[model samples]
Target chain A: MLELKNITKKYGNRTIINDLTANIKDNEIMCIVGPSGAGKTTLLRCISGLEKIDGGQFILDGKQFDPTTSENNVVGVVFQDFQLFPNLTVMQNITLAPELVLKQDKQTAQRKAQELINQLNLDGKESLYPYQLSGGQKQRVAIVRALAMNPKIICYDEPTSALDPNLRDEVARIIIDLKKTKVTQIVITHDMDFAKKVADNMLQVQPIK
Target chain B: MLNYIFEILPSLLSGVTTTLQIFFLTLIFSIPLGIIAGVGLISKFKPLKAVLEFYVWIMRGSPLLLQLIFVFYGLPMMPGIQIVFPRFDAALFAFILNYTAYFAEIFRGGLQSIPNGQYESARVLRLSYWQTFRKIIVPQVVKIVIPSIGNEVINLVKDSSLVYVIGIGDLLRAGNVASARDVTLLPLVLVAIIYLALTAILTFILRRVEKHFSYWK
Candidate 1:
């Protein structure tokens, strides 16, 4: 279980997330929905340890999680823009984190990446750069890249914003498919229908006035 | 005019060798140094960024001929510093330092052009700082800066003529000497042709490089 207790985040005098609290059970798909400027992205950044929480404690599996001392590889994020490294091929993108961060051997990492690529239906597109891929293909590549890290939690930030309605439904389907694998997912999005389709639990964030 | 060219050809050829030496050496040292300095300029450490900015300011603010003279003559005359070098070495040192400043600015612009999303993605991927720069950022920066760097390189070919002010017998100086000896402008015209040919070859190579990067485009 992942427990966030009294989380507070401030930017100078204004508070973005003030004493917000929530819990995510293992393998649960929790969706956080909010309007713009509600700090949903900031909250995701804090949970991923990209931003510092002014006041909070994270308890994971009955132990207090310390961001400073821990390696903090527990969460992986898929950025809203897909932010694929433009220079690397799809295969390179998927294999990099596994080889670099996990210290897996090249053959092993490549093999695992190939499996994920096949599973995500990205077959035969391994050598293409991010620019060459369509919106749906790039999104799948991004998901595969995140999955290759084998993090306990995968967070999607505005996953469908760049996609058309058809692609958005496709992404929702992909998320529902991933839910079967029993990895926890935290999705931050403005798409209400998408939230309804995939979320096992939902939390709404209100902007601080 | 043909006879005059034949007479001065050997002398000018030798000068071309010296000119080529200085050009290659300066490029070899300055390009890498500029990359390091450019990355340093954007580093979070305030002092390092400040020092690099100051160095760039000083180098860009002065003329290349003046810098060559200062490195060759001025520093040796200073009481405490007492830095001294031979004419060729001094000219080379100045050229490298001056071009590095220009290249650094070009590189810094290339680096800054990369969106913040790239870095944020790397961070969330658990890539170490060094890995992120080497694997993700550097390749992209290289592609973005190639055209700007190519322009600078062509300029360097012309700038190599500036070494003549420091008494280095580069191509232009050879032409000047021959012109004075024969009382004709043929050697000077020949020098211009040689420079044009060199830049043409450079342009061809850079075009090939740009084509190579078109895979991303």
Candidate 2:
């Protein structure tokens, strides 16, 4: 289980996420839904170790995890912009972290990346750069890149914001499908329908104002 | 006119060769040096950053001609500093220092233009600091700075003429010498043509490079 206790985040004088507490059971898909400026993204960033919580404790599997001191790969993030490295091909992007951080052998990393590419329906697009991929394809690649680290938990920040209205359903379907893999997922979105459709348990973040 | 041209051509050609030597050497040294300096400027180390900032300030705040004179003449005159560089070496050193500062500032702009999200993505991907810089940041920076760097390169072609102030006998100096000896303005006009030709070639090559990067556009 992943748990947050009284997590507080601030940017200068203004508080973004204020003493928010939440938890996700193993293999649960938890959706954080709120209106804009409700600190949903800030909460997600805090959970992913991308932003330090000014005051809080993150407990994972009954063990205290320090965001400032611990290795950050425990929680992976797929940013709103996708933030794909434009210079690397899809295959290289997925394989790089495994090869460099995990010290996986090149053959093993390549094989795993190839499998993810195929699974994500990005089979022929392995050699293509991020700029060459469509919005949907790019999102899938971003998910695959996150998954490559085999993180215990993955956070998605405004995943559907970049997609067309018609394409938003595809992302929901993808999130639902991810639950079968038994990895914990935290998704932050303002779209209430998406939160309801994919979340096993949903939390609404109130604006701190 | 042809006889007059033949008389000055050899000297001008030799001078052109010397100019090319300085230009290539400065580029070889300064580009990499500037990149390192730029990275250092942005680094988290306060002391290194401060030292580099001071170095850049001095280099950019003063004229290249004055720097050349200091390196070749002024330093030797200092009581404790007994170093005197040869005229060509002093000019080369000064040009490298001055251009490296400009190049470093250009690189800093290119590096900064990359959105913060790029670094964030790399971090969450579990890439080591070095891996992120090498694979993610550097390639994009190269693309962003190419046009700016190209402009500086063309400027360097013109700036090489400044070395003649220190009596290094670059192409402009050869032209001046020939014009004085022949008592005509033709040799000076020829030097202008040579500079135009050099800049034209650089512009053509830079255009091709820009087209190459258009793949991302």
Top of the candidates by TM-score: 1
Clash-forming residue pairs, model 1 = none
lDDT winner:
1
Q: How many backbone clashes does candidate 1 have?
A: 0
Cα deviation of B168, candidate 1, in Å: 1.3
Q: CA lDDT, every prediction?
A: 0.91, 0.88
Chain A of candidate 1 gets a TM-score of 0.96
Overall local distance difference test of candidate 2:
0.88
What is candidate 1's local distance difference test score?
A: 0.91
Which docking band does candidate 1 fall into?
A: medium
> Model 1 — interface RMS deviation?
1.2
Q: What are the per-model DockQ values?
A: 0.76, 0.68
On a 0 to 100 scale, what is the lDDT of residue B127 in model 2? 74
Q: Comparing chain B with the reference, what is the TM-score for each candidate?
A: 0.97, 0.97
lDDT digits (tens) for residues A1-209 of candidate 1: 88989999999999999999999998999999999999999999888878889998888888999553457478888888899999999999999989998999999999999988998899999999889999989999999999898888899999989888888778888888897667899999988999998899998999998
Q: What are the interface RMSDs of all the models?
A: 1.2, 1.7
DockQ class, candidate 2: medium
